[model samples]
Target: MSVVMADEAKDVHTEQLAACVRYVPPEDLKVVAQTYDGAPVMSGSVRGVQAHFREKHPQAVYVHCYAPDLNLVLCHTCKAIPEASDFFNLLENLFVSQCVYSQHDQFASIQEELHIEQRELVQISNTRWSCQLSSVNALMKNFPAVMKSLQKIRTPTALALHSKLSKLPVVYLFVVFKKLLGITEGFHKVLQKENVDLAQVVHYKSAVHDTLVSQGTAQVAEEIYAKAKAACRENNIHESSLGPRRKQKMGDFVVEVSCGSRSDLLNDSEHLKQRLFYPCINRMTSELENHFPNVEKEVMIGIQACLPASETFLCMQSLEKLASQYNIQLVPEEVMVTKSFLSRKGTEAISDILSVFKPLNPMMFPSLKTILQVTLTIPDSSCERSFSSLC
Candidate 1:
């Protein structure tokens, strides 16, 4: 997802939002328009994204009516698009407020919509079998509906219904055996987890069991099932309510440096130079300790803010190179890397330059911090005249 400055963003995160809304286009539009129906294609450009959606999901009238340019759409749709004004329609229910939709937002839309028609025969068979016999009510309900609607016809109509069911992924043993006969038992464990409120019916289980039982290969299916359970028993799955734990964000702390406010007549010029940013540097270290874990005197973390467009980046780069050679990371935890003006220049931050060769967190990789020679770029000769006159 895209990260943006809130102030400049007008309290928005557009880039990240675009990722979630990318898949609103309906499938009917894709089929009707004949634009690569069910084909694997990547969205190559954003120039005509609105037009693309109109062509893909015409049935979703809202998308066609409110087509937006790339920049605007990105901002408006990063989070869930709720139907209700109260945000009730959002996938997240109450009590799980902290849990976001997903950090991997860009792929989320694609995965939710990119369905292939029973490409994996083994998986299809398993599902069909489950629908026919197991708690898979959706499938069982559909079969009778087909039958009742066609009851006016003779026995031939009934056979056609059977044919349709057999062709479905469930009865088609080839579908299950082809590619999808996998992890039935493992998936069952996930559904049965105490925390899960969703019903626990190992989908495709009955179908696979029935097919294998009929084929006299139930022994093989049982072995595969046993292995799946063993794997789950040994492994730990961590579904994050909170993504990765991180040190306090740089924005969370305020910058308060004790410096001489430009005194009258430049009276204390030398004194001011002696400690202009000394307090800030010390505070930086202290802030690092309070916010981050296992931070040393010099470990750096990701800069919360982007580098300003000026000479600051150059200054930061120099400091980063020098800091690299020092012995650090005694405790070795998350390292904070920030871009600073003193060592950076021209749209680049100290962290940006250091990132080329330095470790993300000095606390994690002491050796990642190494001193390197850096070339300095002062102003042209024209500035020398002003400097000399001032001197």
Candidate 2:
């Protein structure tokens, strides 16, 4: 319905959009709401497209794409955790060289040898977190097979890469992020579903928050170490450690521990957990919380005013404010009728509320139908996916 242009100036963009709206016949162009990425340019500062659109198209409402915003948050978080960024880079390189082209046969052979499924590695995309996650999961599932494949390559570069991959730091990060990404990927799928409802959006956000809250740093660190140890055992790879350093004539010499069976193994585990494991988990959770703010309050308020079918999380102030925002006059008799209908219906959903009142005469219901239309129209994030497809 829209065209992309190089000029991103708000006035120019909005002007073009306004022209398009004008070009459409008045009867056909009904309920013009815009759904866009939640970037500064679109919802820029105080005076942005949201404001401009409101002024021009009085009935139009602006909605931000929730999933894309969450994706952006994860994108920034990847940058924040250097180890994770490096691991993701490794996954991309592995995918291109081994998964896609040259050594794919070798990888498949190794997977067969290891008695694992012959799954192809996922290709990573800049915009898709799910891609990154699937890539990580493939790597984790076939880590031993992948390492064995590299060893069988009989190339200096492959051998050197194998050496780098054996390090504890890399392995620990791989395991930690693998679990975290699994959680996030689930959330992403739920948000992008077609039947996703307004109440479910609020419900899922709380569920994610609670899940993150339940996973404490120490517990997460423990889980990471356990997984890393299991991977080491399964692969028959010796987990080496930089053992104690002793004073020498040359200054100091550090001894290397070949097997991770030393008395200070617990100490080593704790040290790694403190240094690397805890920080990344904290960063991701904090960033997620910051990005997914409690829009539930305002959303519930608005819904209650329009639908007023459910009493859960309802506030009178929110109802009044929402009414003012939509310029709807909430007469006492109308409120009584709405509440009485709800009482008989026994707390119906927004869609059901709309259907219930749809058959009623407009003269008798007046503002109720308008409220139902506005309230039932939940903002969707699927527009971004559709736009990406067109591009």
Q: What are the runs in model 1 whose C-alpha is more than 4 Å off?
A: 1-137, 141-145, 148-151, 154-159, 166-391
* Per-candidate local distance difference test: 0.24, 0.61
Candidate 2 segments whose C-alpha is farther than 4 A from its true place = 1-33, 46-48, 58-61, 195-199, 243-267, 293-300, 304-314, 331-340, 343-369, 388-391
Which candidate should be chosen as best, given TM-score against the real structure? 2
Over 1-391, each residue of candidate 1 has an lDDT whose tens digit, in order, gives 0101010111233321112111111111111111111112212124343235546543211111000111122122222221111111111221122122441232233333433121101111211222111222222223233223223232453444433333211221212222122323333333222222101111122333344334333344443334333322332211112222333435667434325422121212232122221222233223322322211222211111112222333244434532342322222221223323134443343333223323234333333232211100000011111122221
Tens-digit lDDT track of model 2 for 1-391: 1211111113423422211121111122444345556666666535876566667665555555576656666678778866567777777877766844558888887788879998887877776668877888888888888898888886776786787677776777778777777777777887777545444555566577677656646877787888887877777767777555433353475445434532222226787786566766677778777666433355446664443334542244555555565677755576557556655655444344445445545576666554545554544442454434322
Local error of candidate 2 at residue 71 (angstroms): 1.6
Task: List TM-scores for all candidates, in order.
Answer: 0.18, 0.75
Give per-model CA RMSD.
32.9, 6.7
Task: Name the TM-score of candidate 2.
Answer: 0.75
User: Total clashes, candidate 1?
Assistant: 43
User: Could you give me the TM-score of model 1 versus the true structure?
Assistant: 0.18
